[model samples]
Target: MKNLVLTFLLTVITVGSVAAQEINWVTLEEALELQKKEPKKIMIDMYTVWCGPCKMLDKNTFQNKEVAAYVNENFYAVKFNAEGNDVVSFQGKEFTNPSYDPAKASRRNSSHQLSRYFQVNAYPTIVYLDENADLIAPIKGYQTPTQIELYLKMFANNDYKTLTTQDAFNEYYLAFKPEFKG
Candidate 1:
């Protein structure tokens, strides 16, 4: 009886942990739809299947409990395949991969039109959009949870609006303090 109770408690704990780690990911269209009802910023993880750094971002940063919680609460998170064949509608325009091949589904395929729209030249770019679905910024490369927290808070609090010049951003960076731990 004690062993049974212990197992049940451990199972419950594991389930809760998994739930916290999982981000509520939505498609670009779905995020736009959700925004129309309740306004929130959009965070798109633009990644290609063939990119190793992209996979690491998924396993390390996105899976972190603090990062996932903050993103799920403050933004509509999107996991967009930058090289996939999904058709995305953004700002009243349709975007797709005209050069996507089924044979290279798991390999390096052609860049999606939406990717070009964001000017994302590299893999694992985190694109943030404003509450009105306007472009905020694209943070390139693999970022740890602590590193990403800075931008996440900066945009969530609309700090980017005042940061027009490079000097302002540099000052902001110098004064900023990261709260998320690994």
Candidate 2:
């Protein structure tokens, strides 16, 4: 009877841990709406269906237990498709992919207007926004857990504003001890 109870307890613990591993991904509009209520910074993951690096980011860095926990606590996480037909209402403007082709949905479709607005030249761009929903910076490409932790902490705490010069940024980069596991 004790062995059966232990097995049940272990199963419950494992299931709860697995459930907490996911990043709380919301839509662009949802993030903005949430910001109005809670006033948290926004972290947008701009990805494409045909991008390999985008998939890797989703599977690797974004899925890391520490990464998800930190991001969930710090920012309003958003998953935006750079080349999809989703209508995004941002900054009092309604943006959509007017040229989105349904036949090419799985491949390289036309870029969304919101993607153009951010001027995302590459896939897997991680765009950061202030609590006011203003653009901060867009870091392009795939990032490991440690690599992204730098940006995550910087943006979350508004440290990017103080690091004006490249030298200052370098100093901060060198001094910053990453807590996220890679």
My TM-score estimates for the predictions, one after another, are 0.92, 0.90
> How does each model score on lDDT?
0.94, 0.93
lDDT of predicted model 2 = 0.93
Worst 10 residues of 1 by lDDT: 14-23
For model 1, residues 1-182, the per-residue Cα lDDT tens digits are 99999999999999998777779999989999999999999999999999999999999999999999999999999999999999888898999899999999999899999998998999999999999999999989999999999999999999999999999999999999888989
Clashes of 1: 0
Look at candidate 2 and tell me the lDDT of residue 63. Answer: 89
lDDT of 2 by residue, 1-182 (tens): 99999999999999998876889999888898898899999999999999999999999999898999999999999999999999878888999999999999999999999988987989999989999989999999999999999999999988999999999999999999998777
Model 1: lDDT to the true structure: 0.94
Clashing pairs in 2: none
TM for candidate 2 is 0.90
Model 1 C-alpha RMSD vs. true structure (Å) is: 2.3
